[model samples]
Target: MLIQYRRDIADLQQRIRNRRLQTFGLFGTPIALVATVAAGVGSKVVFWLHTEMPNPIVNTFTASAFILIAASVVQFWAEIGGEVWDDSGTSVRDLKLDLALAEERHILEARRHTAPTADRQASYKERLPPEIVRLRMESRHYRRLHLLMQWLLFISSAAISAVTAWYDPPQPAKGVLIGLGFTVTVITAATGYFKPRERAFNLQQTADAIEQHATAIELGIAPYNAPEEARNLELFATTVEGMRADQRMREQQLDQPQQGQQQVI
Candidate 1:
């Protein structure tokens, strides 16, 4: 049963990843079209600003590289965020479960135990392996990094856009062209970063829920229910068992005597 749970969790993670990638792929074309049209319009305006009327070649080609680079960053963000929001739906459920467990634990402790506090404390004493703890820390680090990088891209694009918008760029036509390009960059960045980070939030919520459940169970307050959020419960269980096994092996070795006999003087 535990093995099956492990498999289920692995499968869920894979599904989420695949869905995110698929969404990004599907969105690529539309994003490309928007970028292309914006570039075309900017080019025409630049031409008109330089001459009495629009010159498509000078404006179009010059702005093409900037627009393309901006578009690439836009696409990168969309691809990264794809389908990550699906986990948000379960956030309420997990939070509710934690609250319910805490309430149940309190009532049970008051009715049956003189000191439920000790039990709760003991439950948390079951320390996770050093490696698992490290992994969890690393996961948080990566999440922060992802968010930071996205924001940096957004701010840079906005600054460039503002510069382009403010400068007359030879005449009104060139100014308009640069302004539009920057405007699109701002919009793309806003969409990518401000969008809900449901997946990461859900995972954190689930981890918290699991901890609460474990505590409640130890206090004899309520039954524990492992969340299927990230399917990490089984991994948690497996890690615990492995740690125990290592301890037992170490104990056995300590109890055994040295195999070789020493020579008498």
Candidate 2:
């Protein structure tokens, strides 16, 4: 039964991965973003000159540009209008529920099998508290967003610098330069003010601490070495809750602006 559940979970994971690839395609989003920007520039140039030239200057983008054009068509077609993540007219929700159910079944089976053993380490590992799970999930989410924004900030700043020297005779287009400047400013401000990295770090730290306590409890180590099994579990649970509360307090502190002591220069 455990093996069957494991296989089911793996199959569901593969299905979800395949669905994501079909929905977004590999390297599709970044390619689409670039293609969109290029199309904007090309369309603007064509509109200003009012001339449509036929012939490929370079066929480098031809293979990749199909994804962008197809996206527009897909969006415009009412009969097949599904956004990258809408999951409309699909079994995405059902698949997710099935995956969760399979995972739960596997854990239950494993725990049942290991209950009589002197060391039920695997059971304890699989029984992580909900707060720890949530913390880890949120940590990764914030870290992902934080890194993406930082990269955007860096790229936009670099692009602005490059654009300043791009045009012939070193005279960049005023409007384009202004637009790039705005983009860099927005990215910089967002990353600087929001501080997703700090939030992720705190959450990860709290989760790690909670997991450590849980491990000690499972191993019959100090603090969790109390004679009663229930007492050890209770102590571990209480410690996890305390860490979770501390994590929340840290997040709230991150949201509030820091006040520096007065400095006389």
Candidate 3:
């Protein structure tokens, strides 16, 4: 029933990210970056001209560069922002409603549990199964490793894209560009084969499952509300292991070919 709301939330998050990037580009990229780059590059070009042809007047070229840079700076500040009030369908105000919907969904889930007190919950965590503790630690390690590798890949790829975009034909940066392009390609291929991101997500999902079950046990939620504590622990552990088994299956799916990845996970 809530799948549509989840999809809406995901879409909203993506749109929000894209909108923020666009806003940053409009605010900072055009005027400020151009002004800054022009000021530095113009001086270098003028110096090169003087070195190659002493007949050219360096002072005139320098003055023109300064004026051009100043103009860019002035123009940058003049048109820095767009309309203050947005009336679009996808405005930020509308996007935030997804968050409210998510909170409502959570409230519905929470209603299933017995009224759990903070103190009791903390005590319950203390008596959590040792196996879960180990699983949680393992999940954290996998999650952190994946996070680091993903950032490295993303940063490297984005750097290559920016460099490639800026590079023109017949330039000295050809060798550097080739090296970076090759490195990014190799890293991308390795990442895709190994599936570090998917592994991390699977591990994290398992961790969340464990935590949710633990919460149910702590709060005396259904099934965990059994009369015998031993039976409840047995059920909890069984449920957690089943969740981990599902996680392992997902990891195996990641190893399969792209065509196989289309099947429901």
Candidate 4:
């Protein structure tokens, strides 16, 4: 049952991964196109509604605003895709770290009685140097890019708003202009708040697990050679198996109702 459950969970995870890739593959292009159109529309609107401003100034503001919005849209799409990629990267890293730690623990089990387990630990050395390095490089690179894009979005928005306020002044149409600015600001802030938190939370969970394992080992309660430690590993394995089983059950329940509803319809 545990084996079957693990298989099911693995299958579900693969499906989720594939679905995300497919979504980015299909929807990302359309999103970019839509953003391009949106930027063009914004430019046209500025040209039509705020005609009193000098041609060069208005054109400059329109260009800046549209470029900002279009860049934001592209950045936003990339951010979404980056989030999924980050999660996948973190998952892979966690798996590698866990496997390396587990192997270390396995070696310790075979040498608990020895005065030093260094010789036994030879087989348990880090196998994730390349994987870890690659992930770190990509992670840092993405973060730097994200920060730069964020500053660009902010500067562009502020420049556009400033130009709008100065040129358009407090006319009746000013209300409409301010409203658009406010709405975009609010939406951007709301998404920004949640997306970063979600990524941080996933990374934290893995870090916590690694810390827990280290602490247990340091206390000698989780020595690889001890019967108690082996029992603990068994229990931990069982718990993981149970979680996979529960996930499978949940998926089954979810699919069953959906299938039934579809059949009825």
RMSD of 4: 17.0
lDDT (Cα, 0-100) at 85 in candidate 2: 47
Please give, for residues 1-265, the per-residue lDDT of candidate 2 as tens digits. Answer: 7788888999988877765665454246556858666875686586645764344532434544666667656643522564544443455567788789889889889888766432344344456778688889999999999999878778877877787778754454767778878887887777767788988899899888987887787789999788877667666666766776877777766766555212210
Better structure of 2 and 3 per lDDT: 2
Residue-wise lDDT of candidate 1 within 185-234, one digit each (tens)?
Answer: 76565545433243344334444544554455445442323443223333
Put down candidate 4 lDDT per residue, 1-265, tens digits, no spaces.
3344445556556655655664464456556656666765676677666655457865765666666566556645554665643443233345445445555555565455453444323222232234334434544554554565566557657766776777656475566566657766864764454343333333334334444444454455544336564455544444434543553453344335456636644
Worst 10 residues of 4 by lDDT: 119-128
> Pairing residues by index, what is the TM-score of model 1?
0.28
Candidate 1 collision pairs: 47-55, 48-53, 48-54, 105-221
Clash pairs, model 4 backbone:
109-224, 109-225
TM-score of 3: 0.42
| Residue 7 CA displacement from its true place in model 1, Å | 26
Q: What C-alpha lDDT values do all the predictions have?
A: 0.51, 0.70, 0.66, 0.51
Which of the two, 1 or 4, has more TM-score? 4
lDDT of 3 at 98: 61
Per-residue lDDT for 15 in model 1?
51
| Clashing residue pairs for model 3 | none
Q: Give the Cα error of residue 169 in candidate 2, in Å.
A: 6.7
